[model samples]
Target: MMFMMFSPYSFLFFSTYMLFMFSLFNITNFYYYWSVMELMMLLFMGLSYTLFVSSYSQLMVYFLIQTLSSFMLLVFYIYNLPSLLTMAFLMKLSMFPFFMWYINLIYKFPNFMLWLASTLHKLPPMLMIKLFSLELNTNILWLSIVLTVLFSGVMMLMVLDLRLLLVLSSIGNNSWFLLSQMVNMFVFLFFLVIYSFSLFFLLNSFKGMSKPSLVSSMSSNPYALTLWVLSISGMPPFPVFFGKMLVILSLLMTVDMNYFFMLFLVMNSLMVMGYLQSVMKYFIYIYSSNIHYMLKY
Candidate 1:
């Protein structure tokens, strides 16, 4: 039913992503972990769809579901109405200030579970935010956007572990998706697909190498490494580049595009580019040496 509800292109994209996950991690080794996370994600998505269906108004659906979930947890007894819903949504996304759990999960969980947590698990909450955002305050939205971008960018720069770097990158990408919601839904979906594909190949590269200290040193296949770097950086010619271009063009068309917002976008783009430059430079260093010399370091 959910498959039918999604547009054909989106449905195909989701199906392909699932297939990539299954193929990347042989099912037998991670069967139990995969099944549990899949069930939880399904339940979350199901409830979101139910809410969307039950109420004609998107805002009312968000309010009612958020309230009901809170009541179930006895939150209604302790918190005011607005706080209840606010806390629920923040918890749902594991957003700023409440994001410690999310970071810990990424740092501790096995690759299979971390994949779900950092990617597919974000979909339901993000979908609800997109649907119910019609009347969301623009000022508050922009504030959250700025915080998300800044926080994620800082974490990405600070993280040394390759997996942790990917986790922070995923968070930044999620923020970009949220920003895309304000611009264009089609572009958002396209961006999601590109990110998923890039992540899949990047993770594949990680599996082939043992060292987690240096991503370029660890990537045995330079071609795959280059593709992953280019795609994530949203460099020209990649599908991600087109997706990002559409988002930027859409944002430019918006009447509310202020200098501050434009400056933020430029900074975010530069941050991503800086990371990619370092990755590529390291890859060049590795490639310049003999295999033994590269591996020794």
Candidate 2:
């Protein structure tokens, strides 16, 4: 589950990507013309993953097959080269600088497609990040994580739009990849899966709401929705709580820079508080409105 050194990580991602994409539409709504663009995006992304992985594997094998001296020399040269490949994969994942495009795209897509993009489309890029992060410089990685988490958290608090909030949340959640590096793969994957489920449940509950809907109308299933929100907020008893606990424990052991870890904790607390406030605001909206007004919308 960690790096999967012996397995073909590429094929696994390719398969998961296909399954998630296919699962988004049932027979009733599986129209070809309606989702032509999305289908094309999936096809292109899948093929790109296959090619990149295959080429990388071939290159590594070629290097390994060479004499030891030649292999070490090649490694030295490669190490000195710029990390363009890594940057490209991160761009595809919509991390940081590349993320604004994704934020804009989510608004144009339907909720179901949004779920697929937010969860499934993220698989290969995540695997690539995990694989590369092991070899990349730790200092650079830590700096990127700190910047992304703080910036995304602040932006999330400022947004009133539901879609933007979700997008920022996804970006903030992406920090779990960095956390995974500190602890173990299980913790990272646990957070990823639980967060995906939270998003899926939340989006599904928004079925009858308007575009740019207020957070107050997120769901009629208030209990379920609240649980999902709290879980994502890293509230206890949820898997996210365990994941964060593991990350914090690992961070304490492996890194001496406790202040950075403290920053992460503070930012997470603020993010969760903002989410609860939004939910409470929704409840107030419900109480203040008439039954006719609620039914009319």
Candidate 3:
């Protein structure tokens, strides 16, 4: 099961390496669209399993591809080369006006797969953001911030499923928190622990209730649902809540008041909405007459 889930990501890395190599020698178009960035990302996940063919060779190739693609994008942005470069960066980062691939990918993947992709694959973009922010003007930073928040907000509003909505909300929150620049290794490690625990609990509960021919057990199994929901929602007592709070505090300390406030409110509001929707849906399913119907063959 784990292998099946991670196969796409490895395959994607391999394919991205191939594409990057192709781009290096074929210099006709020095610039490419942001959509190419999205395609590279898609390919990375879609080809994740290819790593098994030759782990050492493939891993080296994957790293090289990632490095080259990243460098090219950086040069494009740093040189103030062209709008296409900025667009490519935006696409790579899954920002607005080029966010369709992100939404579609999340919808297609299972909750666990979605979490893996979002959390693990975010390193490149985060590195890029850190690099760019150090060199770019405040205007560019703010623009990137606005686009990320808006794109996430819109997707959260549109997605009906609880998992996908949470994923979207997480992306927005991650973007806003990252802009703060005060986030350190300890904070990231803590967030990882909390996120992993919550996701594990949720997946376990889902599996428990999804047993064949079993009626929806989430409501009757309030303890399980409550634990999962509270952890995921970043409610008090969970590491995520404290981590997120610190991130907001850091944002307040680093960025302007207005930008911090705007991002904080929007991201938190979406999270709250997603939590409420999840709770409501579970309750509805629990109380509905169709519960038995859903479970029956």
Best candidate per TM-score, number?
2
| TM-score (C-alpha, index-matched) for candidate 3 | 0.63
lDDT of 2 by residue, 150-216 (tens): 7777777777656667777777766666576456556666766776777776776774321333465
- The residue-by-residue lDDT of candidate 3 on 55-96, one tens digit each, is 344444444545455666767765775555655555555665
* Top lDDT hit: 2
Q: Which should have the higher TM-score, number 1 or number 2?
A: 2
Clashing pairs in 2: 216-282
TM for every model, in the order presented, reads 0.64, 0.65, 0.63
What's the alpha carbon RMSD for model 3?
A: 8.8
For model 2 the local lDDT of residue 91 reads 53
Task: Kindly list the per-residue Cα lDDT of model 1 for residues 1-297, writing each as its tens digit.
Answer: 123334455455445555544442233332343343344444434433332322334434433444444343244323434444444555555555455556654444434334545666555445544544423445555555666667777776665455676666666666677767666557667777777777666765665311122454456676766677677767778777788778878888874778657756855764485557557556657666768686898
Q: Which ranges of candidate 3 are over 4 A from the true structure?
A: 1-72, 77-87, 131-134, 143-147, 154-158, 180-185, 208-222, 289-297
Model 1 TM-score on a 0 to 1 scale: 0.64
